[model samples]
Target chain A: MSRLGRVLLGSLIPIVVLVIYAFATRSGLDPYYPSMASISSRFSELWLFERVGSDVWPSMRNLAFGYLVAIAVGVPVGLLLGMVVWLHDLLAPLIDFARSVPAIIFIPPLILVLGIGDVSKVLIIALGAGFPLLITTIDGVRKTDRALLDVARAIRLSRRRTIWNIVLPGAAPSIMGGAQTGLQVGFFLLIASEMVGASSGIGYLMMRAQASFDSPTLWAGIVLLSLMGFVLNLLFLAVRNRIIHWHLAMRAVSGSR
Target chain B: MSRAMRKSILGVAGVVLSLVLWQYLTVGGPLAQTPGLPTASGTFERAVKQAGDPELWSALATTLVVTLAALLIASLLGIGVGLLMGYSKIFSTALDPLVQFLRPVPPVALLPVALLVMGPTSNLAILMAVVTAMWPALVQTLVGVRGVDNVTLDAARAMVLPPLLIQTRIVLLSALPHIATGIRIAASYALLMAIATGILTGAPGLGRSILFAQQAGDSALVFALAVYAGILGLAISQAFSRIEGRLTRDYGPTAEAAAS
Candidate 1:
C-alpha cells in the first residue's frame, strides 16, 4: 500500500470500531454533554468548569514540578557517575537494580509518609521521572567521543570549559531521549497517584468519574492525559532537533525527508 | 567472599545512616502531623511486625499468582505474533500500523473498559496484563529476527535446507538478544499491569490490600505493602535480566561468526 493509504487505513480502523460501538450500544449520553449555555441558570454547571480547572492545574503543576526536579537531580548525578570511572564501576549494578524497579512501587510508601496530598504525588512523579533521566544522561555522556576530548585537550582548553563545550553538547541527544522517557513515566505515575488519593488533579478526577460511572468524563480525562504526553514528546523532539544540530542523528533526518 | 561480606556491611551502614538522618529531619518538622507519614523507625517497626502476619503472606501469594500468570500469557502471545511478523514481510506490513497506534495508549486508560467487559476476575487482570505487555515483546522479536543476516538465510536456502529446520536452527537463535530485550520490557509491564488491574478491581492481592489499608488510614501497613511490592518488582526484573543474559550468551549470533 502507498504511505497515505496505509495511514488512512491505520486511522480508519479505530474510528470504524467506535462507530460500531456507538450504534450497537446506542447508550444515551445526552446528560453527559457539557451545557455551556446554562451559564446563570444552574450553579452545578458552573461548578463543573471550576472543578475541571482546579483539578487539572494541581496535577499539571505536580507533573511539571516533579519533571523539573528530576531533570536537575538526575543530570548532575548522571554526569558525575559518567565522569568518575571508580564510581561508575562500583555503582553500576546498584543503579541498574534501582532503575529496573517500577516507580509506582514507591507511591504507597510515599503516600504513607507524605500523606494523601500534593507532596507525595509530586515526589512519586519525581521518583518515576528520575531513573530514566539518570540512566540515559549517563549513557549519553559516556558515549561522547574520546577523539573530541583529545581535541579539547590538544587545544589547551580548561577542564571545565571542555566539559561545558564538548561533553554537554555531545550528550544533549541522549539526555533529551531520557527526558522524553521520564516525562511519559511521570505522567503515568501521576495518574496512579491521583487515583489512589488526592482531592485535586486529573487522576483524582478520573477516580471520581469512575466512582460516579461517568464514562464520558472518564474518557475525557484519559484522552487529555494521553494528549498531554504526546504533546510533551513532540516538544522534546523539537527542542532536541534544534539543540543537537551537530549530531549525526539530526543530520540523517534531512536526507530522509 | 569476605570482600562481598564487607560490601554488604557497608550497604547496611549506609541504610542506617540515611534512616537516622530521615528520622532526625521528620521528628519535629512540618511532616510530623501527617497521618500514615511514618518516621524511619515507625516504618521499620511496621515492616518487622508485618513480616509475621499470615494475611500479608497470603496477599503476597495472590499477587505472585496474578503477576506470574499475566507474564506467561503475555510472553507466549507476544513471541508468537512477533515471530510470525518477523518472518513474513506481508504480516509485518499489515500489523505495523496497528502496533504503532496501540503502543502509546496508557494501560491505565483501558482499565474501565476491561472492568466493563470482564467484570473483575483473575481473567480480567490477565486480559489487561496481556494487552499492556504484548507490544514490547512483539516489537523486540520483530527487530531481533530482522537483525539476522540475509546472507546466512540465503546460504541455508541454497543448501536445500527445509524452512522449518532453517527457522529453528538459524532465525530463532539469531533473534535471542532481541527477544531477550522484549522479555525484559514485557516482564516489567506485566508486573505493573497486574497490580494495576488488581487495585482497580479490588481483587485479592497486595494491591487490594494496599487500597484497603489506605481507606482505613493504616499508614504503617500501607508503607510495608509498598516496600514488599517494590521488592517484588525488583526481584522480577533482576531474575528476567539474568535469564536474558544467559540466553543471549547461549543463542545470540556472534559477530565473528556472522562476519565469516
Candidate 2:
C-alpha cells in the first residue's frame, strides 16, 4: 500500500472513535461526555480571548524565562565541572542527589519561600530543566576527543583558544540533545508548578475548570496544553537540526555505513 | 595520598562544607530572616524521624506499588506493540503519525481528564503513569527489533525453523538489550507520574505528604520527604542499570550504548 494510504488507514481508528464519542454525547447516551460542538466552542473561546491573555500567554512567558535561565546557568557550569576533574569529583554525589529528586517535589517549598508568583514557577522549571542539561553538557565536554586536543596543542593553541574552537564544537551535539530533553522537563514542571499554586496559566485554568465541573473547558485546556507541547517540541527540533546540521550529517553517514 | 583517596576525601569535604554553609545561611546568616525555612540540622533530624512515621511509610509504599504495577503494564504493552510494528513495515507506517503526535504530550496534562473519567483514585494514577511510561519502551523495542540482522532471519527460514522458535531465539534475544533501555527510561517516568498523580489528587503517597507538609509550613518535613523521594528514584535507577549491564554483557552493547 502507498504511504498515504497507510497513514489514512491508521488515522481512521481515532477518527471513528471521535465520531462515536460525538454521536454518543449528542444523543445523550452519556451526559458526562462533552459534545464535539461544545468542545470546539470552548476551544475557540479560550483561543480567542479569555485564556489567551490570562492563561496561555503567562504559561508561555514562564516557560521561556525558565528555559533561558536553565541554559544560561547550566551550560557554563557544566563545562567548568566537566573540564575540572577535581571539581567534578567533589560535586558528583551532590549533583546525583539533586538530579534524582523530582522537580515537582520542590514546588511546595518554593511556593512557601517565593509565594504564589511567577518567580517560584520559573525557578521550579529552571531547576527541573537545568539538571538534565548540566549532566549532559558535562558528559559531552568530558568526552572531548583526546586526538583533537593533541592536534590543538600541536598548533600551539592557548588553553582558552583550544576550548573555544575545538572543545565546544565537539560537545555541541550532546549539549543540544540535553537542551531538547531540558525543554521537555521544563514544560512538564511548568504545568505542574502552575497546578500546585497559581491564579493563572493553562494548568491553573484546568484546575479551576475541574473544580467548577466545566467538562468542556477542562477538555479545551487539555487540548491547548497538548498542542503547546507538540508545537514547542517541533520548534526545538527545527532549531536543533539547523544548529547542528554538520553533526547530524556526520551521524547519518556513520549510521548508514 | 593516592588519587582515589584524595578524590574521596575531597568529596566528603564538599558534602561537609555544603552542610555547614546550609546551616549558617538558614540559622544565622542573611537567609535566617526567611520565614518557614528550616536549619540544615533540623531538616536532617526531621527526615530521620519521618522515616518512622506510619503515614509516611504507607504513602511511600503506595507510591512504590503503583509505580511497579504501572511499569509492568507499560512494559508488556510496549513490547507487544513494538514487536508488531518492527515486524511489519505497513503497520509501522500506519502508526508512526499517531505515535509522533501523542509522544510529546506530557502525561501530567492528562491528569484532569483522568480524574474526570476515572475519578480521583489510585487506579487513575496508575492509568496516567502507564500512558506516560509506555512510549520509551515501545520506541526502544521497535528500534532494537528493526535492527535485527536480516541475514540471520533468512538463514533461519532456510533451515525451516518454526516461526515461534526463530522469533524467540533470534529476534527477541537480540531485542533484549534495547527493551532493557526502554524499561529503564519508563521506570523513571513511572515514578515521576506516580508522585505527580498522588500529589495532584491527594491519592495517598509521599507526594501528598510533601504537599501537606508544605501547606502546614513544616519546611523540615517537606525537605525530608523530598529526600526520601530522591533516594527512591536513585535506588530504582541503580537497580535497572545493574540489570541492564548484565543483560547487555553478551549483546555487543548496541542498544545500551545508544541509550546512554
Candidate 3:
C-alpha cells in the first residue's frame, strides 16, 4: 500500500468496528456496548470546549508556576552537583532519598505548611517535577563525552566558555527529556493537590462534580485536564526540538524518545 | 583504611556540613519565623512521636497493602499482554493505537470514572494505580522481548523446542530486564497514587492520617507522616534496585545492559 493508503487502512479498521458496534448496540443486537447516542452525548459533555476558562485557569497557573520553579531550581543545582565531583558524592545519597519519595506523598505536609491556596498547589507540583529534572540533568552533565571535553580544552577553550558552549548543549536533551516527563507527572499531581483543599481550579471543579454526582461535568473536568497535559507536552516537545537541534540524541531517537 | 574509605568519610562529613548549614539557615535565621515551618529538632521530635503511635504503623500498613495489590495486578496484566504483543506483530500493531491514545491520559484523570463506578473504595484507588503503573511494564516488556537475539530464538527452534517452552525459558529470561524496569516504574507510581487516592477518598491509609493531621493543624504529626511516607518510598526503590542488580548479575551483561 502507498503510505497514505496504509495510514488510511490503519485508521479505517477501528472506525468501521466502532460504527458496527454502535449500530449493533443501538439496534439491540448487543447489550454490551452503550448506544451511539449515549456515547456521543458523553463525548460532547466531556469535551474540553465545554469548560469555561474560570473553571480551568487556576490549575494551569499553578501547573505553570510549579513546573517553571522546578526547572529553575533543578537545572542549576543539577549542573552544580554534576560538575563538582566532591559535591555530587556528598549529596548523592540525599538526592537519591529525595527522588525516591513519591511526589504525591508530599501533598499533605505541603498543604499544612503552604496552605490550600496556590502556594501549596505550586509547591506540590514543584516537588513532583524537581527530582526527575535534577536527576536527568546531573546524569546528562556527568555523561558528557570526555573526548569532546578534551578536544575543547585542546583548542584552548576557557573553562567557562567550554561549560557554556559544550556542556550545556550536550546535556540539553537529557535535561529537556526530564523536563517533559516532569511536566506530565506534575500535571497528574497538580490535579490531586487542587482536589485536596483548594476552592478553585479544575481539580476542585472535578471534586465538586464528584460530590454532586454530576458525571458529565466530572468527565468534562478530566477531559480538560487531559487536554492541558497533552497541549503542554506538545508545546514542550516543539520548544525542545528547536533548542536541541544539534543534539545527537534528538537526531538518533527520531524525535520520539 | 583505604582511599575509597577516606573519600567516603569525607563525603559523609560534607553532608553533615551541608545539613548544619541548612539547619542554621532554616531554623535559626529569618526563615525560622515562617509559619508552618518547623525547626530541625521540632520536625525530628514530631516524627519520633508519630513513630511511637500504633495507629501510624497500621495506617502505613494499609497504604502498603493497597499499593502492593495495585502493583501485583498491574504487573500481571501488563506482562501477560505485553508478552503476547511482543510475540505477535499483528497483535501489537492492532493495539498500538489504543495504547497510544490511553497512555497520554494521566491515570488520575480516570479518578472521576473510578469514583463513580467503584465509589471511593480501596478498589477505586487500585484501579487508578493499575492503569498508571501498567504502561511502563507493558512498554518495557515489549522492548525486552523484541530485543531478544535472533540467534537465541533460532537456536531454540532448531532444537525443536515447543513454543511454550521456548517462550518460558528464553523469551521470559530475555524480558527480565524490561520487566524489572517496569516494576520499578510501576512501584513508584503505585505508591504515589495509592497515597493520592487515599487522600482523595478518605480511605484507610497513611495518606488519610496525613490529611487528617494536616487538617487538624498537628504540625508534628504531619511532618512525621511525610517522613514516614518518604522512608517507605526509599525502601521500596532501594529494594527494587537491589533485586535488579542481582538479576543483572545472574542473567549476563547483555540482560543487565538491556534492563533499564
Candidate 4:
C-alpha cells in the first residue's frame, strides 16, 4: 500500500475506537468516560475563554523561562567543566549525586525556601532541566575532534576564539541533543511544579477538574496539554534543523555510506 | 600524590566545601533569617533518626513497589507493540504518526485523567508511570527490530523454521541490546512517575513523606528524604547500566553510546 494509505489505515484505529466510545457514552452511560462531544465542546469553551490566559499562557511562560535559564546556565558551566579537567574531576561525584535526585523531590524544599511562588516553580524546572544539558554539553565539549583542536592551536587561535568558533560548532549536535532532552524534562517538571503549589497553569486547571469530578474539563485540559506538547516538540525540531543543518548533512553522508 | 588519589581528595573537598557553605547559609549566613531551614548537622542528625523510623521504610517500600510494577507493565506492552510494528511494514507506517504525536505528551499531564478514572490509588500511579515510561522502550524496540538483518531472516525461512520460532530466536536476540537501553530509560521514568504520583495524590511513598515533612515544618526530615530519593535514583540507574553492560558485551560500543 502507499504510505498515505497505510497512514490512513493506521489512523482508522483511533478514530473507530473514539467513535465507538462516543456512541457508548453518548447517553451518559458512563460518568467516567465523558463523550467525545462533551470533550470537544469543553475544548471549545476552554479555547474561547477560560484556559488561554489563566492556564496555557502561564504554563508556557514558566516553561520558556525555566528552559532558557537551564540552557543559559548549563552550557557555559558545562563548557568550563569539560575544558578544565581538574574541575570536572573535583565535581564529578557531586554532580552525579545531585543529578540522580528527581526534580520533584526538590519541590518541597524549594517551596519552603522560595515560598509557593513563580520563583520556586521556575527554579525547580531549571534544576530538573539543567543537569541533562550540562552532562551532554560537557561530553560534547570534551569530545571535540582532536584534529580540530590541533588545527585551532596551530593557527594560534586564542582560548576564547577556539571555544567560540571551533569547540562549540564541533559539539553543536550533542549539545542540541542535550537541549532537546532538557526541554522534555523541563516540560514535565513544569507540570509537576504547577500541580504542587501553584494557583494557575494547565496542571492546576487539570488538578482542579479532577478534584471537582469535572470529566469534560479534565478531558479538555488533557487534550490541550497534549496539543501544546506536540507543538512545542515540532517547534524545537524546526529550530534544531535550521541551526544544525551542517550536522544533519554530515549524518546523512555517514548514514548513506 | 597519585592522580587517582588526588582526584579523590579533590572530590571529597568539593563535597565538604558545599556542606560547609550549606551549613553557613542556614545557621549563620545572611540567609539564616529564614525560619525552619535546617543546618547541615541538624539535617544529618534528623536523617539518622529518620533512618530508624518504620514509616520512612514503609514509604520507601511502597514507592519501590509502585515503580517496579509500572516498569514491568511498560516493558511488556512496549516490547510487544514494538515487535509487532517491526515485523509489519504497513503497521509501522500507519502507526508512525500516532507514535510521534503521543510521544511528546508529558506523562505527568495524564495524572488528572488517571485520577479521575482510577481514583487516588496505586493503580493510578502505575497507569501514569506506564503511560510516560513506555515510549522510549517502544521506539527503541521498533528501531532495533527494523535494523535486524533481512539475510538472517531469509536463511531462517530457507530452513523452514516456524514463524514463531524465527521471531523468538532471531528477531528477539537482535533487538535485545536496544530493548535493554529502552528498559533502562523506562526504569528512570518509572521511578520519577512513582514519586510524582505520591507527591500529587498524597500516596503512601517517599514523595508523600517529603510533602508531609515540609508541611509540618520539618525541613531537616524533608532534606533527608530528598537525599534518600537521590540515592535511590542513583542505585536504580547504576543497577540497570550494569545489567545493560553485561547483556550487550558482544554488541560493540554502539549500545553504550546510545545509552548516554
Candidate 5:
C-alpha cells in the first residue's frame, strides 16, 4: 500500500505539471508553450513514421555507422595500448588532451573542411564516440587481476588464447560502459551537427521548427527525441547485460557484502 | 632515464611527431592544396595573435562566466535534490522515476526549446546546462549518502550530536569525496553546454567565435580558436581533477583504491 502510494505521489508532479500546462496554454496564453493537445496532435502527425524515411533513418544510419567505427577502432587500439606499456605511456598525454576536448567542438572544423555532408557527420560522430571506449578499455585492461594473468601463464596459454579467454572477458564490463557512453555522446554529436548544418534529420526538423516558431512541431520533436534517447539507453543496457551478465552478478553479490 | 622521465620524453616526442605530421600535411604534402586546411605554423601564428586580441579574451571571459554560473547552479540543485532523495525513502521513490525519465533525454534535445523560450541568451545555456550537468552531482551524492557506514553513524549518535549537527558533520563529510567527483563532472558538462549554447544559439562566447570564423571562411582562425577551446577544456578538467583528488585523499578512499 505504501509503495503504491509513493508511486502515486511520485506521479502527481508530472500529472499536475501537465494539467497546469494544458490549462495555461488552452488558448495560447503562453507564447512559448504550445497547448498539450496541439503538441500531441503534432507529435502523431509529423513523427509517427511519417518523417521516418527522410529524417529518422538518415540520423540513425549515421549514428550506427559512426558508433560501429568507434568500437572497431577503440577496442583493438585500447587493447594494444593496455598491453604495451611503453606505447600507453607515450600516448597518455595526447589521449588525455583529446579527452578534455568536448566531442562537439570538432563538428565545426570538420564541416568546414568536409562540407555539410554525411561523410563529415559520420566522421565527427566516430571521433566523438571513440574516446570513451578507448579510455574505458585501457582502464579495464589495467585493472585485470595479476593472479589471473599468472594462472594463464602457468597453464601455458597462448597469447591469443590468453586475451580471448581471459583479458577480453575481464574487460567486457568496462568496454560495455564505454560503449554506452560512446553511444550517448554519439547521439549528442548527431543532433548538434544536424542542428547546425544538416539538410535532413530530426535535429534539422527541430531547428527548422524553432526558427519558424512552430512550437507544436518543436514540442513534438522533443518528445520523439527523448523517447528515442530512452529507448537507445534501454537497448544498450540489454546489450551490456548480455556481454557482462557475470560481471553484473558479481557486482550484486559484492554490494550486499 | 627514470620511468617518469622516459614517459615525459616519449610524450613530448609524440606531440612533436604529430605537429610535424600536421605541418607537412597542409604545407608540403598531398593535402597542401585542400581548401580551409591551414598549415600548422599558420594556425599557430593565428593562435598567438588571438592571445593579444582583447575581443578574444572578452569572449573567453563570457564563456567562463556562463560555464561557472551553470556549474554553480547545477551543483547546488543536484546536491540539494539528491540529499532529499537520498535521505527519505518516500522522496526517493517519488523523484527517482522522474529523474530517470529526464536523465536519458539528451540535453541538447531541449536546447531548441530553451532557446525558443529564453531567446538565445546566457539564461538558456545555464538552464539547459543545469538539466545535463546536475546528474553526476545528484547520482554521486545519492550513492555517497546511501553508502555511509552504519558504524560511523552509530558513533556519531553515541556522541549525542543533534540531528542537524549529525547530518552536517558526519553525513556531508562522508559524502564530500563523491560530491567533489560530481562537481568535477559537472564542471566539464557546464563547459560543454556553455560552448554548445554559443555555437547553436549564437550567444556570445568562444563557440560563437568559432562559428563566426567558420562563416567568414577564416579556417585558420577557426582551427586556432578550436585549439584555444581545447586548452581551456583541458585546463579546467585538470584543475577539477586535482582538486577532487586532494579532497578524496583527505576525506576517504579514492575510487581506484576502493576498487583494489
Candidate 6:
C-alpha cells in the first residue's frame, strides 16, 4: 500500500470504534459506559494541567527513579556475571528461583513492612523491573561472539578497549531489547504498586474513581494511561533506532524476524 | 571435577548458601528483630503445613483454574485474530494502529473497569488475563504469519495443495517455534495476571491468602504463601519454556527467520 493508504487504513478502526462508542454511550442506557464527550472532558479536567503536577508527576518520577536504578544496577552486574562463568553458575539457581516469582508479589509485604511511602513504592518498582534487564543483559553478554573475541585477543587488544569496542557493541542489541522490556515492566509495576497501596498518583486516582462509581473520570484515567503508554513506546523506539541503527539495517536487509 | 559436575555442585551450593543466609537473617542475624518477618525454616515449615490444609489446596486450584482457562481462551482467540490479521494485509493495516496504541498499557490498568463492570469474580480475573496475556501470542503469530516463505507457499500451491492445507502444514509448521515463544510468554503473563487479580480484588487464590495472612498477622504464612506462589510460577514457566526450547530446537533455529 502507499504511505497515504496505510495511514488512512490504519486510522479506520479507531475512527469507527470512536464513532460507534460515541453514539452508543450518548444513549445513556448503561451508567458504567460513560460517553466519550464526558470522558474526554474529564480527561482534560483531570490530567490536562491540574493533576499533571500532583498525580502524573509522582507516578512518572517513581517510574523514572525505579527504572534508572534497575538499569544502573542490573547492567553492570549482568555484564560481570555474564563474563564470569563461575560466578554466573554459582548464582544461576538462586537467580532463577527469585526471578520466577513475579515482582508484584512483593507489594503487600513491602507496603506492610515499610509503610505506604514513596520509598516502598520505589523499591517495589525497582525490584520488579530489574529482573528483565538483568536476565537479558546476562544472556546478551554471554552470547557475544567468540570469533570476535578471538580476533581481538590475537590483535592483543587491551581488555578495556576490547570491551568498549567489541563486547559492548555486540551486546548492544540484546541490552537494547532488554531495556525496552524493562521499561514496560517498570510501568506495569509502577501502576500496580500505586493501586495496591498509594494515596496519590494516576493509579490511585483511577482506583478512587472506581470506588465511587465515577465512570467518566475512570474512563478518562484509562485514556491518559494509554496515551502515556503510547508516548513512552515512541520514546523507546527513538532511543533504540538511534543506538542500534546498524542492527536494524541488518534486519531490514535480511527481512523481518 | 568435570565442567558439568562442577556447575551442578555450584548450583547446589548457591541454593544452600542463600537459604542459610535467609535463615540467619530471619532467625538470629541482623534482621532477626524485624517484626512479622518469618525465619526461613518457619516459612518452609508453614508451606508444608499449608499443603496439608484442603482450603489452601482449593485456593491453589482456583488460581490454576483461572490461569489455565485464561491461557486457553487467550491462545485460541489470539491465534485466530492474528491469523486473520496476518492473512489479510488490509485487515492488519487497519488494526495494527489500534493494537499498537494499547500495547504498552499494562493489564493492571483494567482493574477498575473490570471491577465495576464484571464484579470481583474469578471471571474478572480471567477477563484481565485474557486481555493481557493474549498479546504476546497474537503479536508473534502475526509476525510469524508474515514471515512465511513466499516461495514455499507458491511451491505448495503448484503441488495443488488447498489453501487451508498450505496454511496448516506449511505456514503453521514454519511458525510453530514463534508460536511456542508466544505461548510460553503468555503462560507467564496469564499466571501473573491471575494472581494479581486475586491480590488486588480479594479474589480467592494464593494472592488472597497472602492478603488474609497479613491481615491476621500470620507473617510466616504470608511469607510461606509467597514462596509457594513463586514455586508455582517457576514450575509453570519452566514447563512452558522447556516446551518452547524443544520446539525451537526441533524446528531448527537456522530455519526461516529467527524470532527475536
Tens-place lDDT digits, model 2, residues A1-257: 88678879789767888888877889534435788888889899887776588788888899999999999999999999999999988998888778778888888888889998999988998999999899999999999999999998899999999888888888899999789889998999999887889988888888877777788887777778788889998999999999889988997876521
The candidate that wins on DockQ is 6
Report how far residue A257 has shifted in candidate 5, in Å: 9.6
Give the Cα-based TM-score of candidate 1 against the true structure. 0.81
- Ordered list by DockQ, greatest first: 6, 5, 4, 2, 3, 1
TM-score for chain B in model 6: 0.90
lDDT of predicted model 3: 0.78
Candidate 5's C-alpha runs over 4 A off are: A1-3, B150-166, B254-260
lDDT per residue as tens, model 1, A71-169: 999999999888876566556655655675556656766766677888888788888899889998899899999999999999999989988998988
Chain B TM-score of all predictions, in order? 0.88, 0.88, 0.89, 0.86, 0.92, 0.90
lDDT of 4 by residue, A1-257 (tens): 88678768879777887889878988865667788888899899887666688777777888889999999999999999989989988898899899888888888888888887888888998898899999999999999999999999999999999999988987788899889889889999888888888888878878888888888887887788788789999999999999999989987776521
What's the TM for model 2?
A: 0.93
Q: What lDDT score belongs to each candidate, Candidate 1 first?
A: 0.74, 0.86, 0.78, 0.85, 0.88, 0.86
| Best candidate according to lDDT | 5
Residue lDDT tens for model 5, A166-226: 9999999889978987998899999999998889999998999899988888889889989
Candidate numbers, best lDDT first, in rank order:
5, 6, 2, 4, 3, 1
Fnat per candidate, as a fraction, reads: 0.22, 0.59, 0.52, 0.69, 0.62, 0.65
Q: In angstroms, how far off is B136's CA in candidate 6?
A: 0.4
Question: Which wins on DockQ, candidate 2 or candidate 6?
Answer: 6
Decide which is better by DockQ, 1 or 4. Answer: 4
Q: Write the per-residue lDDT of candidate 1 for residues B1-260, one digit (tens) a residue.
A: 57676556655655566667768766886666666677778877888899899998988787778778877888889999899888876667667766755565566766764565456677777777788788788888888887777788889999999999999889898888888888888888887777776665676677778777766777777766767777888888888889988887777666446556
Give the alpha carbon lDDT tens digit for every residue of A1-257 in model 6. 99999999999988988899888898756779988788888988988899899988988998999988998898889889989999999999889888878788888888777877888888888887788888988988899999999999999999999888987888889898789888988898888888888899988888888999999888888888888988999999998899999999999998666
**Residue pairs in candidate 4 whose N, alpha carbon or C atoms collide under 3 angstroms:** none
Which regions of candidate 6 are displaced past 4 Å? B149-165, B255-260
Cα lDDT tens digits for candidate 2, B41-86: 9989998888788988898899999999999999999988999898
> Model 5: how far is B166 from its true place, Å?
4.5
